[model samples]
Every structure is written in structure tokens, then in C-alpha cells.
Target: MTSEVTIRSIQAADTYPLRHAVLWPQESIDYVKLNQDEQGHHYGAFCNGKLVSVISLFIDGNVARFRKFATRPDCQGQGIGSQLLRRVLEEAREKGAQRIWCDARAVNENFYRAFGLEPEGNRFYRGTIPYVRMAKSL
Candidate 1:
């Protein structure tokens, strides 16, 4: 998969498009909320220097909570999510995080489980859809 993919932190200028392309497609993503409370770390995956996926990690104490993880629809099946997740998890471990956790979209539990995460509790709703709380010890 030497497709010249690079993973790095999000740039401020990419706030809007990255949100639209990844976080919320039909409804507009609220960049203002982030501007007012920028409390997380965001990572962007690039293919040939063009962004193809985005993942955000919200750190709270010793845990890292991943959020808004999305890969370009066209690139979804090609392992971009897996790669980005691997890097993000590694980064968390390096940063002294004792645990890495996330609200995995209901349908994506198997994918997260493949990386050794275990469901910690019952599914919870985010807006309307449900998500599972998955966690792994770093």
C-alpha cells in the first residue's frame, strides 16, 4: 500500500471541508463550535498530499476518545481507516495515555474489535443513531 499516504495533524484552514467531507455531509458541520472550544486533537490522512480521511481524538485525563473518524467514501474499502486508526492509537500510547477508547459506530464494531477493543457497555445514542463504547489498554 505504498500509495504515498501520509497522516498528520489537521490544519486550521481545513476545518470546514474536512468537517463536511467527513463529520457531517447532509447537514452543515458547525465549525464555530470547534472554534470556540477546540479541545481535541485532529488527524488527517493524505494520499499523494490530498486529504482522504480524518480522525479526531478527545483526551480526557488518562483516556483518549476517538471521534469523527471518516474516510473518503471512495477510499473506504482500501484500508485507510485501519491505517489512520493504527497511527492515532500509537500516538496516544506515546503521549502517556493509559487507555484508548471511542464510540464506535454500531456497524463498525467488528472493525474496532479486530484491533483488540472490547465493548465496555451498552450502546448509546449520539443524536439518533447508536454507538458502542469500545476501549483497549495501551
Candidate 2:
């Protein structure tokens, strides 16, 4: 894949395939859809004209939460997700969010920490998968 990545706002529907492929392959496609999708802001990262990463941000009051962050398996470790994350974090700050968080998969806690988000509370599970709430003040 080319190293050139473009990050931009996208419709929530555009995030489903990647969300399903990378985050919930065993679930039905409908399981990947968020009920409040129309109320959130979605973004995608494209490399060489192919979508490679996706994240959704929901801002409420002074808080913002990002969800369903995923990168194509083949595109992992290429920094594309990093760029997309930076974009949404910046977007959150610009939109007046004072704190941003996510229910990050436990295995990726270190990855989120590298971006300055700290784990909060005890670890929890969604189905059989473990997760932790990570957050940072913007």
C-alpha cells in the first residue's frame, strides 16, 4: 500500500465495512451500526484511494467519545490510524470538547496511552472481549 494517506469526514455508513472487517467479523454487519450514528461525526483514512481506517466521534457537553476505531489488518502499523486519530482529537478540541475518551480494547491500551490517554476504572468486558475506558483532557 502507498504511504500517502488522506483523512476526511465521512458518512457513518462508510465506516461499516471496515468496522465489521477489522473489529467484529464474527458479528452481523448490522451489529456494527451505531444507533446514534446520525448524531456523530465519522472519519476515514484512505491510502492509495482505498479506505484503510475508520473512527467515529460523538461530542456531548464538554466530553467527546470516539468509537469503533479500526484499521485494515494489512494496514496495521503503517501510521494511518495515528493520523486519523490525531485528526479527530484535534476536531474534538476545536469543537469545544474538554475531555475525550474511548472504550479501548485492553490489548490496545498501550497504543492509546502513546497518544496520552490514560486508563480509567477497572477493566471490563464486552461479550468475551476485554476493554478499558481510556481518556485524556484536550
Which 10 residues in a row give candidate 1 its minimum summed lDDT? 28-37
lDDT of 1 by residue, 1-138 (tens): 668788899854454576576656766666323542377777888998889888777777788878777788877888887899999999888877899998788888999999999999899996777889999999
lDDT of 1: 0.80
Off by over 4 Å in 2: none
- The model with the greatest TM-score is 2
Q: Which residue pairs clash in candidate 1? A: none
Q: Kindly list the per-residue Cα lDDT of model 2 for residues 1-138, writing each as its tens digit.
A: 456899999999999999999999999999999998999999999998999999999999999999999999989998889999999999999999999999999999999999999999999998999999999999
Off by over 4 Å in 1: 12-16, 31-37
